[model samples]
Target chain A: MTKPASSHQTLNDAGEFAESIPHEKLVRSRTAQAMLWVLLIAAVLFAPALLYPVFVMQLLCFALFACAFNLLIGFTGLLSFGHAAFFGGAAYICGHAVKVWGLPPLLGILLGGVFAAALGYVVGSLAIRRQGIYFAMITLALAQIVYFLALQLPFTGGENGLQGIPRGTLFGLDLNNPLPMYYFVAAIFLAGFLIIYRTIHSPFGQVLQAIRENEPRARSLGYNVDRFKLIAFVLSASLAGVAGSTKAIVFQFASLTDAHWQMSGEVILMTLIGGMGTIFGPVVGSVVIITLQHYLADIGSWVQVVIGAIFIVSVLLFRRGVVGELARMLKISSV
Target chain B: MLKLLLAQGMLGLNNGVFYAMMSLGLAVIFGLLNVVNFAHGALYMLGAFVALILYSYVGLWFGMSGFHIGFWPALILTPIIVGGFGILIERFLLRWLYKFDPIYSLLLTFGVTLVLQGLFVNIFSASGTPYPGMPDALKGVVNLGFMMFPKFRLFAIVFSLIVCLIVWYVIERTKVGALLRAGTENPELVKAFGVNVPLMVTLTFGFGTGLAGLAGVLAAPIYSVSPLMGADLIIIIFAVVVIGGMGSIMGAVVSGIALGLIEGVTKVFYAPAANTVIFFLMVVVLLVRPSGLFGREG
Candidate 1:
C-alpha cells in the first residue's frame, strides 16, 4: 500500500513524527493483554451457567453492539447518534430473511451485516461532510427516517414488529435449544470483539486516530481522511448489525423498540458509563446497564430518571467512567 | 383539489409557526452558547404543564371555583418561569462545560431532558391532558371562497409571525443585538470591552428557553399537553435546524415554514411519507450544501 518513495517522502516524515511521540498504548504490555483474554474466556465459559443462558446471550448482543459503537465514537472520534438504525434495521432484515425466505442462520446474519454496511456508506458519505455537532444531528435525522420506514414498512409488521423469527439450525446444531444458542451468541461476540481489536491495532486504525487527533494535519500528510472515516463507519455499522441480528435470533423477534431513538441514547449511555475510548469499557457498560434494566423493570418511568441521573453524574463528576476510572487507579495509561 | 390544498396549506402554516419558534430558539442558543439544548423539548413540555397547573390545581387550591389563570396570563407567565429555570440550569450546570468539547454539553442537556421528561411522565402519566379551548374571541372559523380556516389556528400563525419578526428585528437591527452578535463571535474580546459575557450567555439561554416555553403554551390549545409532545416535535425541529444551517435567524424561520409546507404537500400526495419527507429534504440539502443553505463552513 506504500506509495513511491519520492511521492510519499513528506507523508512518511509526518508518520514518523507521530510515531516518535511516546504514545499511551491501550494495553500497557503483552502480559496485560494475555490476562485480559484469559479473563474474558473464563467469563464466557462460566457466566452462562452462573446466570441464565438467555440473559448472557442478551448481554453478549449488547456488548458487541456497544463495542461497535465505541469503534466510531471512541477510536474514530465520530459520534453517530443513529447507530440504532444499523442495529435495528439489520435485525428486521435478518429476521425477515430467516423467517420468510428460509435462509441459513449464518447467511441471514451475514446479509444483515452487508445491508448495514451499505446503509453506513450512504449515511457516512452525507454526514462526514459536516463537522462535530452537525454530523451528530444529521445522523440522528437520517436514523429517524429509518425509524419512520420501519414503522410504515409492511415487512417490518409496523408497531407490533416482525415476530416469531425462527432460529434455524446452524450446521445441524439445534439453535432452538438455549445452550446451543448461548454458545452461538458467545462465539459471535468473540469474533466481533476480535475484529474490533484487530482493526484498532491496524495501520488503517492508526491513520484514523491521526485523522481524529488532527484532521488538517492528517490531510496535509496526504491521507484521504474522508475515505478512512467512511471505512471505519462501515465497519462499525456492520458489526452493530451483527449484534442486532444475533439478538433477534436469540429472542425470536424484531421490534420497533430496537429502532427507536431511545435505543440510540441507550447505546451512548452504555459507552459513556463503561468508559469512552477504552477497549473493555463497552462490554462492562452493557452488562451493568442491562442488569440494571432487568432489576429496575418494575419501577416504570423512574428507571429513566435513574439512567438520566447516571448520565449527568458521569458527565459532570466521573467523566472517565467505571473502566476508565479503574485504569486510572491502576496507573495505566490506557485500558 | 384547490380547496383541499388551501386547507392543508393553512394547517401547514399553523404547524410552521411552532417549528419556526422552536428552531429560532435553538439557533439563538446554539449561536451564543455553543451548546445544543437537548432539554429544549422537555422545557417546552414544562411550559404547557405549568400553564395547566396554574389554571387547574392552583385555582382549585385557592378555593375559587373555576378561577383559571387563563391564556392571556399564561402567555406571559409560563415563559418567565421556564426561562428562570433555564437560567438556574445555566448557572449551575452548563457554565462549567463551556471549556469542554461541545458533545459533552449535548450529553448533559440530553440527561437533563430525560430527567425532566421522566419526572413528568411519572407524575402525569404518559397520556395527554387536554387544555381548555381558546378564548371566545378566537372560537369561530373564517371562510374564504376556496377554504375555511380555524380562527385559533389563524391567530397562532399571525401571533408567531409577529413574535418571530420582533425577535429578528431585535437581533438584527438594534445596538444590543450588535453586542450579542459580537459576543457570540468573540466572547473574550467582548469581555475585554467590559461586557458581562457570562451573564449575557446565561440570559441568552433563558431567552431561548423562554421562547420555547411560549411556543409550548401556544401549542397547548391545539395538541394535548403531554410529556412526549416535545420529544416528537424536537426531532422535526432539529431537521429544520439542519436545513436552515442554525447560523441565521431568517434561515431558521424560512426553512421551518418551507419544510412544514413541503411536509403538508407530501401528506396530500402520500400519507406515509409525510413523517419522513423533511429528513429526506435534509439529506438532499446536505448533499447540495454541506454547510446548509445559509450556514458558514467551519
Candidate 2:
C-alpha cells in the first residue's frame, strides 16, 4: 500500500511539477463537463451561417497548425521559425498526391504528414545543435531553402501552384458539400487536438515537460534530450501537415502563399496571440484571427499591420493570452 | 579575360555597397539590442519613399527658390528623419520588451515591419517610384582602361565604403563603443557604473535604423524605389548577418561585402537561380560553422 501511494505521489509530482495546481481545481464535476460538451454540440449544430462551414474549416486547420507549433515551443522549449515549410510543403504534397495520383484523401493526407515528418527529422537534427535565437534563425534559413525548392520543383507548379485539388470522397461519402465537410473538418481537428492532449499527458510528455523546464536535469535523469526533441519535431510537423492537407482540400488550391515566410509568421502570431503553452489557446486564437481575416480581407494589407500591432501589444502587455490568462486566473490546466 | 574580370569586379563592388550598409545596420542592432530587427528592411524602404516624396514635391517647391536640393541633401536628411522615427519606436515599443526574451523583440520589430510596409504600399500604390539623377555632376560611364563602369554606381560604392569605415571606426575604436559593448554583454554591471543604459539602447537602435535609411537613400538613385525593394534585399541581408556572426563589427562589414560579391558572381554565372543561391550558402555556412564564420562558440 505504501509502494502504491509513493508511485501515485510520484505521478502527481511528475505531471504538475512546475505549477502545483490542486487536483480539486483541475478535476471538473461530471455535470459541468457534460454541460460543456452539450454547449459545444449545440454551437456546432447551430453553426453560424455567413460562411460558417468555411470559417470552422479554416479554424480547424489553423488550430491544428498552432497546436503543432506548440508541441515544439511549449513541450520541447524549441521555437521553430519555419513551420510554414512543414505546413505548406504538406499542402503541396497532399494536393499533388490526391489530384495527380488519384490517391484517397486519407492516404494523401497521411503521405503529406509523412513528407513533412521526414523534413522535420532532417531540419530538427541540424537545428537542435543550436539553442534559442540561433535555432530560430537556422530553422528560418532552412525553411527559406525549402521555399526556393518549392518554387523550382515541377510538382509544386511553381508560382501558380497546384490548384483545383479534388476533395474526393471520404469512404465513398461526398465531402464536397459544405455542411458534411464542416463535420469532417471538426472531427479531424478534434482528433488531432486529442492526440496532442494525450501526448502531453503521457509518460513521454512528462519527460518532455522536464526537458522544457530544465534540459540538463532531464539529461542527467537519463532521458535522451536530442532524441526526444527530434521525435517531438516529427510529431509536430506531421500534425501541421495534417492541417495543411485538410486546408488544401477545403480551399481546393495550394499556392506559394502557403509556403511563404509570411505564412510562417502568421502561424506564430496565431499561437502567440492565443497562448503558447495552453491547450485551448490555439483554438481560440485561430478562431479570432481567422474571423479577423475574414471580415477584414477587404482592408487589404492593413490586416498585416493590424495583426502586427496585436503581436506587439500582446507580447509586451499580454503574453499570457486569452485562454492562457483565463486558465491562470482559474488556476487550472486544460491539458 | 582581364576586361571581363574587371567588369565583374565592378559589378560586385556595386552590390557590395548595398549589402555592406544593410548588414552593417543589422549588426549594429543585433550587437546592442540582440534583436534581429525584421523592420530594418521596412525602414530602408521608407527611406527610399522619403527621398521620392522629397524629390517630387519638396524639390518642386524648393526649386522655385533656386535651392536645388538633390541626392546630396537626401543622403544626409532622410536618415536623420528615419532615425528620429526609430528613436520614437525604441522608446515606445522596443525599450519595455528588453527585459523579456529576445524573440519578443524580434516579433515586435516584425510587427513594425508589417505596419511600415503597409503604409508604404498604401501611399506608393505598389508600383515602382523612380528618382531622378544629380545635375550632371556624376552621370554616364567612367572608363578605367580595363572596364567602363556607371559613374553613379561607382560613386555609390565609394560613398558606402566610406560610411562603413566611419561606422566601423565608431563601433570598434571609440570610448562610446566601449560603453555600448559593455552594456550589450552585461547590462546590469554597465548600469551599476552609473550610465543611462536605456538611453544608450535607444540611441543604438536609432543609429542602426539610420544606417538602413542611408542605404535606402543611396539606392534610390541607383535602383528603382519600389514598395517591394526592401523585402527583396532583407533576406539577403539576413544571410549576410548570419554568415558575419553578429559578434564582430569588422566581420559584419567584411562578410556583407563578400556575400554581395558572391551573389553578384552567381548572377553572372547562373543568372536564372541567383536569388536562391545565398540561402543555400547559408545552409552550407551553418553546416560548416554553426556559430557562423565569425561568431564565437559560447
Candidate 3:
C-alpha cells in the first residue's frame, strides 16, 4: 500500500488560471449537459410508453437530491450526513399542505422548499462552526432529531405515514395522470438542475470550489469563509428539499423512511456512484441505481447487501465514480 | 422524589454501560485511524445474533437453554469472534482507504452495515430471536424497599464497570498504551521506533470493534436479537461520542453513563417524549460546545 500523500500535491500548482474565463464561453462549452437535459426533456415529452413514469419521476427526484448533496461535498468540501432533515422534513410539510391544507401542487412544492431552506439555514449555521468530520456528525445528530420528530408528529401519521395524497391541480391543470405528472416532475428537475449548473459555472461557484481546494488560502485572499460555507450548506439542503417534495407528489406519500439516516446514506451513494463535482453525474447515478432497484426488487433484502458491495468496490477501485472518471478521460472539466 | 431519582439513576447506570462500551470503541478507532467505523453497530448486532445462534443451534446454554454458559463466557467469546472479523476488515477493505478521503471509509462501512443487516434479515427474518439471561443465579428481583430492581440489571451495571476499569487500566497505564497514544499523534515517529504502526492500527481497530461486540453480548438478554436492534442504538452512541468528546476514552465512559441516566430520568418524568430528549440535549450541547462537553478546544 502506498503512503497517504498530502492533498496539496493532487491540486494544480498553477492557480487562478481559469479565473478570467468568460461566462459565455464556459456556458458554450457545456454541450454535454445541455444535450443531456434536452434528451431528458424529449424523453419526458414523447417517450411515455417506453418508461414507467413513476420510476422516471423517482430517478429525477433522487438525481436532484444527489446533485444537491454534491453541492456541499464536491464544491464546499463538506460531507453532510444529515441531509435527510432538509429532504424529508420538506416532504412532510409539502405532503401535509397538499393533503390537508388543500394547496396547489406548485405552491406545496414551494412551501416544502421553503421549509427545508429554513431548516438548512439553522443546521448549516451551526454545523459550519466545525470542520470535516465534526460537521458530518453534527448534521447527523440534527437529522436524527428530525427523524424522531417525524415519528412523533401527529401530522406525519407516525409509523403508518401520510399516504393517499392527491396530486391535485398543477395551476388548474390536472396532474393525476402519469404523463402529466411526469412532465411536471421533469420540468421541476430540469429547472433545479440548470440552476445548479449555472451556479457551478458562475463566479460564486469558482470561489466555493477554491474554498474546497484550500480554505486557508481562500481566507488569506480575504474571503468570508464562514458565510460562504453556510450559504453552500443551506443551498444544498434547500435543493435536496425540492427533490424530496417532488418525490412526495409523485409517490403520493411521505413516511418515516424518508427521515431515516439510511436515506441520507443512499443519497451519498447516488452522488458517489455518479461522480462528485460533475454536472450530470448524479442524474446518471440516479438512473443506474433506480434501474437496478427496479430489476433487483425481487431479491428483497439482498439488495442492501448488493448496494453495500458496490459501495465498497466503488470506494476501493473506482473512487472517482462513473462520470467523474469519465469526464477526466474525455478531458471534459465540469460535466 | 428522592426514590424516583434513585430509580432513574440506576436505570441510567444500566444504559450507561452500553454507551461506554460502544462509544469507547468508536473513540479508539477515530483517534488511531480517524475512521468512524459505521459498521460498529452491525458488528454489535452480529455478536448478539451469534450468541443467540450458539444458544439455539449449538445448545450452548445461557438463559433458557438447559446447559448454562452464563454471561461471562459469552462476553469473552463474542468480542474475540467479533474482533477477529474486525481484523479481517482492517486488513482488507479498511486498509486501502487510509490514504483516501475519510468519507470513503464512512461509505464503505455504511455499505458493510447494509450487507450485515440484510444478511441477518435474510436468515432471521425480522422476527426477533430469544435471548434469555444468565442462570437462576441472578434471575430474581432484588428489593431495595424504595424500588424493586432486577438482579440482572444490577449485575449488568457492575460487570460493565469492572470491564471499563480493566480497559482503562490497560489503555491508560501500560507501556503499550503510551506507544498507542504516540501513534495517534505521529505514526511516523512511532514507526521509526520499530513498533510496527500498521499492526498497531489493525490491533486498535480490532480492539475497538471487540468492545462493541462485548456490548452486544451483554445487551442480548436485555433486548431481543433483532436485525434493527443495534442500528438506532449506534446513532444514539454517536451522540454520546460527540457529547463525551471523541478523543477521550474516560470522557466517553462518563458521558455515556451520565447521558443514559439523564435519558432514563427523562423517561420517568416526561415519559411521553423521553425518546428524543437525549438528541435534544445533544443539539443544545452542540450550540453551547461544538467540540463536545469534554473535548479540548482547537
Candidate 4:
C-alpha cells in the first residue's frame, strides 16, 4: 500500500485535478521544467513555418481557453459548463469594439476581457450559492440567458453573427498579416499561461486547491469558501474571455458558434483530454482535437460523434487522459 | 389581453408538461444515484424517434412499406425500448463511474447525449420530421369555454400530470419506493437488509429514463420531432431542475409547469424575454433559496 508517491495518479485524475496529494515524487525538478518551457517556446516560435499559422493560432486560442477552464475545475474544484457565454460573448464584444467602435485591437480585446470578468462576477455570485452539479447547472442556465441575449441583441447580427472584424493596428504593426498576428497571440497566450501558473503557485491558489480537495475543511478553517470560489470563477471566466477575444481578432469575425453550449463542451473536452490541472495538458488537448477537427471537417456531425466517443473513452478507460497518462508513466510532473 | 393570456397559458402549460416529465426523471435519477442525467433530453428525443420510426419507417427499408406501427403501439413500446436502452447504459457505462466524482457520470451522460444528438443529426439532417399522423381519436381542436386547443395537446398535458402524480405517489407511498429511498440514504444499510441496491439503482435509472421516453412519445405530435429539439429544451429543464431542486418531486412538477406558463405569458406581454424568463427566475430562486424551492439544504 505504501508507494513512493503519496497518491495514485489515476486517483488524482479521478478527483478532477492533477499534481499531487501532500508530498509526492511527481513534481518535475525546476531545471528540467525550465528547460522544457524553453524548448516549448522554441517549437512554438517555429511552428508557423512548419505548419499553418492560422492552424497554430487556433490551437493556441483553444489551449488558452482550456487552461482558463482548468483554473476552475482543476484548481478550484468548480466545473462550469457555461464558459462559452464568456468565450463567445467576449468574441462579439471584441469584434464589435474593433470593427464598429474603431478601438485599437489591444483595447478591444481588453474590453472583451473586462466584459467577461463582469459577466463572470454576476454568474459566479449566483452559481457559488450551490455546489457540485447544481453549480454546473446554474452556470449553464445563466450562460443560456447570455446566449439568448446574444441572439436577440441588435449588434450581434443574429444568426450571421458579427462579421468581418478588422485586425486593427497595434502600435503601427499591421495585424492584417498573419506573422504579426501570431506573435500578438503567442504573447497573450504566454501571459495567460503564466498567469495560470503563478495563480496555482500562489497562496490564493493554495486555498483554491484546498477548497477543491475539501470545501468543508477549508470552510472550517475560516476561509470564506464561496468568496474564493467566486474569485476563481471570475478569474477563469475572464481568462476564457481573453482567449475568446484573441480568437475573434485572429479569425476577424465573431459568431454564435462561440457562445453555443457546444463550445463550452469543447473547452471541457480539451481540458479533460489534456489532463485537467496539468500545465501543458490543455495545449496538448487543443492540438490533438483542433487538428482532428481540421482534417475531419468535411464529415460534419460525424465529427461530433467521434469527439463524444473520445470523451467517453477518456472518462472510462483513460481517466488520466493523454498527458496525464504520459506524466504518470514517466513520473515527471505533468507538463 | 385575457384571451391572449389564456391561450399563451395553455401553450406554456404544454411546454411545462415536457419540462415536468423530463425534470422529474432527472430528479429521480439524481436523488438516488447522485448522477445528473445529462442525456435525459437526448433520451426524450430518442423516444420521439422511436415513435416516428415505428409509426412510419418500421419496415420501409425492408420492402414492407405498408407495415407501420401505429401511434398507440408506439406510445406503449417507446418507453420500454428507451428504458431498456437506459438499463444498458446504467449497467455498462454508468456502473463503473459510481466511485469517482459524480461529475464524471454527468460528463459520461453528456458524452452520450452528444453522440446521440450527433448521430441523429447526421442521419436525419437537422430538420425534424413530423410524427406522420395522429389517430382520429386525438385529432381536431377542442373548444374550451374561452379558447380552442388541440385535443392531443390537452391529452398530453393531462396524461403527463397523471403520470407525474403516479410517480410522486409511488415514490412517496409504496414499499418499492421505500427501498429506493432507503438505497439513496444508505445503499450499504439496504444491502445489509438483503435487498439488491445496485439493481435498484439500475432500475431507478431505467424507470426515470422511461418517463423521459414517455414524455417524448407524448410530445412527438405536438412539435416537429427533430435532432436538435432536445438540446434547447434540456437547458430550460436544467433551470427547472435547479429551481425545483431535484430532491423534491412536487417541486419539479409545480415549478416546471409554472415556469413554462410564466414563459408563455411573458411571450404575450414581452416576446423578447420569453425565452430567457425561466433562466432569470432560476437566478432569483438560487439567490432566495439556494437549495431550490423544495430541496433540503445540503
lDDT, each prediction: 0.87, 0.81, 0.83, 0.88
Error of 4 at A292 (Å): 0.9
**DockQ for all models, in order?**
0.50, 0.33, 0.52, 0.57
Model 1, span A6-51: residue lDDT tens: 1221346445644342334444545566777899889997898899
- Tens-place lDDT per residue, model 3, B41-125, is 9999998987776556555443454764456677678889899999999999999988776777977888889889989999888
lDDT of 2 by residue, B155-249 (tens): 88998999999988887789998898888788899999999988898899899999999988888887788887887577678777777787888
Q: Put down candidate 2 lDDT per residue, A1-335, tens digits, no spaces.
A: 01111122133535655555566875753344455557655555566464567877887899899989988887777878889999999999999999999988888888998999998988888888776666777788778878887898878889998998998888668979887778887888778888998898799988887777666667899999889988998899889989999899899888788887788888888888888877667777887888899999999977877887888788788877887787667666645
Considering every candidate listed, which one attains the maximal TM-score?
A: 4
DockQ of 4: 0.57
Interface RMSD of each: 7.7, 9.2, 4.0, 5.5
Which DockQ value does candidate 2 get? Answer: 0.33
> Which ranking of candidates, highest lDDT first?
4, 1, 3, 2
Maximum-lDDT candidate = 4
What does the i-RMS of model 3 come to? 4.0
Q: After superposition, how far is residue B140 of candidate 2 from its true place, in Å?
A: 1.3
TM match of model 4 to true structure: 0.96
In candidate 3, residue B163 scores what lDDT? Answer: 86
Q: What is the lDDT, from 0 to 100, of the residue A99 in candidate 4?
A: 93
* Candidate 2 ranges beyond 4 A from true positions: A1-19, A28-51, B1-9, B59-68, B133-135, B144-146
Top candidate by DockQ: 4
Provide C-alpha RMSD values for all models, in order.
4.4, 5.4, 3.3, 3.7
